[model samples]
Target chain A: MAERIALIDYGAGNLRSVHNALLAAGAGDVAVTDSADIVRAADRIVLPGVGAFGACMSGLSALPGMIAALDEAVCRKNRPFLGICVGMQLMVDSSEEHGSHKGLGWIDGTVRPLAPSDPQCKVPHMGWNDVIPRGAPPLLEQGEAYFLHGYAVESDDGADILATTDHGGPVAAAIGRETMIGVQFHPEKSQRYGLALLERFLKWRP
Target chain B: MTLRTRIIPCLDVRDGRVVKGINFVDLADAGDPVEQARVYDTAQADELCFLDITASHEGRETMIDIVERAAAVCFMPLTVGGGVGSPDDARKLLLAGADKVAVNSAAVARPELIRDMAQRFGSQCVVGSIDARAKNGGWEIFTHGGRRNTGIDAVAHAELLASLGAGELLVTSMDRDGTKDGYDLDLIRTIADRVTVPVVASGGVGSLDHLVAGVIEGHASAVLAASIFHFGTHSIAEARAKLAENGIPVRRN
Candidate 1:
């Protein structure tokens, strides 16, 4: 049987693009569904979204049995979990976008807006940015990918950070511990460098 | 660390094939959009922008099929433009796998469209595309593939778009377009000073030095060119290497 990859679709954003990207990355049995059983049983789980932190949390909350299912699959079973963009921010404790809103709290951190001191520096840091790898992750061996988020996760425990990218300061780009990984940048949209990372993640035994 | 100067390859698609020219005139056949995208992908171009030049006036929807096919094949982030006049259109393109959507005429006609799209789909996905021509003494906004004049100051409009929730600006000079003389530095500087968003300097990029000048002198976030790349005059790798040598900090292959 082919390895099943469950893509959580809570109607946040970029669900189809993420699904298509996985398919392009050679994922044979990718299913874009919010079913609890399928999510729990899948070999890998991908959470992808492109919206505000508060909005994403609400979407995840609105989903029937989604939080419980994701928690069971990631925290309990410790299956390979990957979060992209706002999905990565959702892994943190809270965000500052639309006032204070609670997140999944999987990682102890807060999502704050990027601050570029130069008056010319734009908000919602979009487009391709260079990823400066701090701790070596097998997936990021290729190079940097595209990032399109306004808020970034500032972890309480800095050791969880896998890579950093500079805009105003060194912002955390990727975070992981054992089987769970969260990336602020969109690996699916990062082009060749991103594809290589996804391939590595798919092939990772752990 | 210094930011890298980006080399972007733009494709003007008419009936699915990539065409090139100055001021959208004397259209020369480039190649198939999918094939051209793949070539740029392999060549290590920083990003790709596909503009459906004739989609809007034709009263047709944005080409989602071509966008999807190109997105599936190309590894880099794709920005799709032309005929995206509303949030729904922007949503459709994003759903079709566009990393960003560039809006020019629509945003000009209705400034609120930028804010609405940004609110719904996040600001990063919204790109404000400006086509400006120097007239009399100041730069004026030109719409409909540089055929119609909007009588809006280019610099002032760029600032307005940024404030209205556009995440980035793709500024193209109609005067310098297709001239291959190099980008209009004055226009780029003017717009760059006005907006905080990343400004992609388009039109009249002839050589690698011109690309470097665009980023350094113009203070632009990226440099976009058409004829230079389409005619096989300069490769992305070579341009990046040259930029890196000049201390511009480009992603090395």
Candidate 2:
């Protein structure tokens, strides 16, 4: 049977780009759905989002069955799980944007705004940034990828962090333990380098 | 670490195909926008800017269909401009998958338009585009594809635009346009110092060294050029390598 990948579509951001990116990266059995049954049966799962952290949490919270399915698939099955952009932050405990919105709490951390000390450093941290890989993961062996975000998850659980990118300070880029992986940058939009990273994720054996 | 100087490929679209020349002349017809966009997308360009050069004069709605089509094929964030005079226009383009909307003459004519668009959308979505020409030993702002002079100081105008809520400035030196000599570093430095937001230096980029100088000496956030890339003179990969060799941190392919 083909390895199935379930992309969670919570209607909070762009799903087509991520779906297309997976397809382009040679993912054969990619399915974008919010159905619990499909997610539970999938071989891997992807959570993608683009927006404020509070809005994303509300959207995912509204889908209780999907959330439960994702938790079971990731925690119980130990199937590979990847989160992009705000989806990565949702893996943390909470966020500072629009009040303290609770995250999925998969990883122990809190999301906060980018530092405001450097007047030269623009917010939203839009465009390409360098990534310093911490672990010897094939997914992040490649150097850097594009980044666009206003807030990031700062994890005290340093073991979960796979990479860091510097702005005013070093911020988490990829986080994971066992089958759970979260990338703060959009691999779907990082051009060839990003596609390479996604391909590594698809081929990752955990 | 030293920031990488971006090598941006600007596409000026009339109808749907890309066109070019000094002040939007010569009009060499390029391939379909989607196809061209895919080419650049594969080339690993630092960024892409698409200007709907004829949408306003032609009295047609913004070519949102084109934007959507291009976005579908290319994953890089696209900056769309031309005929974007109002917040609604910015919203429409953003909704159509454009990462940002660049306003030129419209923002100059009514500076408040910048703040309004930035407020409705976000500051990150607003880009202030200025076409500048040398006048009386100083640069003057030009409007309507550099056909009319605004008699405003380019440096002062950039400062005002940033203060008015422009997240970035796309400053093009019309006098050096299409000349392929080098970027006007003098103009770039003046505007870069004036704006708090990112400054994208445009016009008259000839060599890889020119791109490096624009960022290192001029302190530009990014550098945009045409003809050189469109005419197949230099590949994006080679340009990036050169910049990186010079200690500029480009995101390598």
Candidate 3:
């Protein structure tokens, strides 16, 4: 039987694009669901988020038992998990956007405003940038990916840093430990590089 | 590598189909926006911009459907604009899979719309569009397809939009629109310098060299053109190559 992937939908933006990208990436059965029960029963989970960190977290939390279900599925069950953009930021311990907001804390870090050392680098880091992998992170490979965000993860454990991208200096592009992986760039918007990443993600065992 | 300068091909949509026009007038049928988007996606164009010129109430639904279809096939970032008047208008496009919503006339009428959109959806999704033309010694904002002069200082308007939390600015020069001359480099540089956010240079791109100049001279983070891509004057690969040859960082396929 094909592995069922649960794409959590909590009224966040880009749910449909992510869903369509997953299907294009060769997933056999992907379920777009808000039900925690469906999430708990899935073989893999993909969290996609857009907009503010606080807003996205609140929206996810607004869905009763969804947080616990994610925790149960990814932490306890050790299922393959992937988070994109704000979804990746949510994996950190907390975020400084719109005041201090607690996150999933799956990874030790804080989501802070992207302050590139060079003032000329610009904020929001809009457009395509290189995803320079640090060592080997499995799902992450060295390629150009589409990035559109003002905030980024500052993982506390340097060992947890899976990939880095340049803005003014080294910025965390992807962070993961064990079966969970998170990317600051949107794979759904990264075209071929993104689709290849998703293809690897679909086959990622750990 | 650093953040590559973006080359976006603008698609003007009317009643769910792509249309090409000069200076936003003299409309002619092009092709399906989804198909054009797929072509750009395959060509590795950095992103795509869709301008919904449909004015009818029912036409709105058709544009939404087109956006949905395009987003399905094209995984690159998509920015949709034209007639976005409210947060709800922006929401519908976002839900339809548009990565960003560009607001021009409505935003000029009510600057607060930019704030509302930036606050509700985050600045990344809110793109402030400034349509300006040379007036006296300075540039002034225009509306209604560069026909109506708002008598607003383009520089101050750009600063205000950026202050209002616009993530990016799409600065288009009415004087150069569809003229096949080139981008208003000074106009683009003025707005790009005033705002910290990325600015997309639009209007009057006739050749790949114009795209290179838009970044080198205009200092824009991205460059947008319709006629150049729609009419097949230059392919995206050739454009990227020219930009790359000119020392501007562009994504190599």
Candidate 4:
């Protein structure tokens, strides 16, 4: 049977685009839903988010049983999980966007704004940037990916830093622990490189 | 490298088909916006803008299906504009799979709409599109396909939109539009310099050098052109190469 990938759609993210990208990456039977049962039943789970950390976190929390299901599926069951953009930031301790908001606290880190030393490095970091791998994580590759965010995750344990990208300095581009992985860049939007990463992610045994 | 300067292909669509006009008249068929979007996606376009140009004249929501179909096939961030009158309309397009919604003439009519959209959908998803013509010392804001003049200063309007929570600004030069001469560097620089949000320069991109100038000289974070990419004058790969050669940071495959 194909992997039952449950893509958490809690009224956030470019859900349709992510779904399509997954299909292009050769993944099958992907479900974009808010149902906790489907999330718990999935063999692999993906939480894709687009927007502010506080807003995304609230949206996720608004759904009853979703987070607990995710905890069971990802934290307990140790199903292969992926978080993209704000989805990645949600696994952190808290965010300093709009106001200081709490996060999932799964990774023990804070989500803070990217303050680039160069005035030219605009906020929202809106465009394609390099993704350089720092530590080996299953299926993780180094390449450019499309990024559109102002806030980034700062993990407490530096060992969790799987990849880094230069904004002004080394910004956390990808992080992982055990079977879970998160990337600041939108692999779905990175074209061939993105497609390659997604394909690797689909085939990853972790 | 830092974030690369983006090269975007603008598709002005009506009734779900891509169309290009001359001075808002003599419209010609280009292609299906969805098909063109897929082509650009394969070409690795940094982003895409699908602006529905027939909003004020005809009242309909044809872009929902277009957004859904294109988004289903393409993976890049897609911005859908035109006929986004209320937050519900924007929500519909978003639910159908649009990443961002660009508000143009309607925003000019009521600048507060920028704040409203920003509040509803995070400011990052709200793009303020301004059409301007060089007037006097500055530039005059125009709407309705550059047919209506608002008499508002372009720089002031750009700053106002940013303050109102527009995360990005799409600034089009009416005077240089379709002329293929080049971007209005002074106009783009003034608006880009005045506002903190990333500004996308539209209109008058004749060649690859024009795109580079928009980024290096105009300080535009991205350059959007239609006829050049659509008419097969230059591919996106060629554009990226030219930008890289000129010492500007660009995404390379």
Name the top lDDT candidate.
3
Kindly give the stretch of ten consecutive residues in candidate 3 chain B with the minimal lDDT sum.
B21-30
Native-to-model Cα distance after best TM-score fit, residue A179 in candidate 4, in Å: 0.8
Which sequence of candidate numbers ranks them by TM-score, best first? 3, 4, 1, 2
> By summed lDDT, which 10 consecutive residues of candidate 1 chain B come out lowest?
B21-30
- The candidates' interface RMSDs, in order, read 2.0, 2.7, 0.7, 1.3
State residue B195's C-alpha deviation in candidate 3, in Å: 0.9
TM-score of 2: 0.84
CA displacement after TM-score superposition, residue A141 of candidate 3 (Å) = 0.8
Measured with C-alpha atoms, the lDDT of residue B181 in candidate 4 is: 97
User: In model 1, what is the error at residue B90, expressed in angstroms?
Assistant: 0.6
Q: Which candidate is the best by DockQ?
A: 3
Report how far off residue B208 is in candidate 1 (Å). Answer: 2.4
In candidate 2, what are the lDDT values of residues B1-253, reduced to their tens digit? Answer: 4234567888888876667522222234344676777778878887789888785544325378778777778978788988887888877677666777899988889999998886555566689998999898989999876889989998899989888878788999988887888888999988887666788889988877888888888888888887777777788887788878877778754
lDDT of 3 by residue, B1-253 (tens): 7999999988888988777623322224336677777778887889999998988989888888988999999999999999999999999999999999999999899999999999899999999999999997999999988999989999999999999989999999999998999999999998888888999999999988899999999999999988877777788788888999999999975
Model 4 chain A scores worst on lDDT over the 10 consecutive residues at: A134-143
Task: Calculate DockQ per candidate and list them.
Answer: 0.58, 0.32, 0.86, 0.72
- Please list the residue runs of candidate 1 whose C-alpha ends up more than 4 Å from where it truly belongs after superposition: A118-122, A136-138, B21-31, B55-62
Tens digit of lDDT per residue, candidate 4, span B19-50?
75112222243356777777788888899988
Interface RMSD for candidate 2 relative to the native interface:
2.7
Q: Is the docking of candidate 1 incorrect, acceptable, medium or high quality?
A: medium
Q: lDDT ranking from best to worst? A: 3, 4, 1, 2
